[model samples]
Target: MKDFLPVLKILLRFVIVYIVLVLLYQFYLNEYENDVVDPFTRWVAQQVAFLQSIFGFPTVLVDSLKLHSILFQTEGRFTTRMVEGCNVISVVILFSAFVFAFYKGAKTFLYVLAGLVILHILNVLRIVMLNIIFIKYPQYERVGHDYIFPAIVYGGVVVLWLIWIQFFALKKTDKS
Candidate 1:
């Protein structure tokens, strides 16, 4: 019983933190009416547009109040739309919950903060590249959006988790 308690505690903490963060995110979403786009998603869309522009795509972020979405258009053609999921807050929440679940010390915040910043940057770049994919290769757009790009973002999160585990989170069971 004693041996299993630690695992159970970590699992419990993970679940609790995950739930709380999800609920708080939901609360943030609920504040915006159906006709409005939330600020965070809009900010992400701006970042995507900014990157695309820097890449010489001449991008414009068009937010439709009625539809509550921001469209990424290049060369006066729609390349992609920024929905709530594209904002990367959910990914940040997931990463944070994991870091907190394995709470060791104050460094947990540093790891989570660094992870989130990287994830946000990664997502913006993902959208910019995905926009190019949508523009240049229409057929692969679905594959990139559904599979390839997501792998990149999640792969980054995994790398952060690994770094945390490798340096800051030595397990109690490890003799070394």
Candidate 2:
């Protein structure tokens, strides 16, 4: 019991931090939805228009969901809302904190950052491809949204986490 006290303290600290972050994110998301989501969504629609014009493709922005507006283009659609918790930045921050808490070094930090960037870019591309798919075959929208897209986005995150754990965390221990 005595030896476990330090470990318990660490776990408690992590829980407190995680809870605070979650609450803050929820508050921010609520405020953002009320104030900024629509305008930002309109801006995204404009960008889609410009991109469609440039690429010579048709794009549609749909308000099917509540949290964020979905943009549908010949290539793909993504949400325009830059809500802090909805996008990759939040993922990066959370994962970086977790990794840093466990690994504790500059190299680990950089790896996490790189992974986060990769995940974000992939997410953007995924949205584009899904939009294209949705436009080409409207019937597939349900399948794409419910299964394919979530798998791609969340699966990408999982892969990134594994890479970080294996190459960054485990590899160093193996070498030592």
How much does each candidate deviate from the true structure in C-alpha RMSD?
2.0, 5.0
TM-score of 2: 0.64
TM-score of each: 0.93, 0.64
lDDT of 1 by residue, 57-87 (tens): 9898887776678888898899889888888
**lDDT for each of the candidates?**
0.87, 0.59
Candidate 1: 10-residue stretch with minimal lDDT: 167-176
Model 1 compared with the native: what TM-score? 0.93
Q: Which stretches of candidate 1 lie over 4 Å from their true place?
A: 171-176
The alpha-carbon root-mean-square deviation between model 2 and the true structure, to one decimal in Å, is 5.0
**How many pairs of residues collide in each model?**
0, 3
Could you tell me which residue pairs clash in candidate 1? Answer: none
Predicted structure 2: lDDT: 0.59
Give the clash total for candidate 2.
Answer: 3
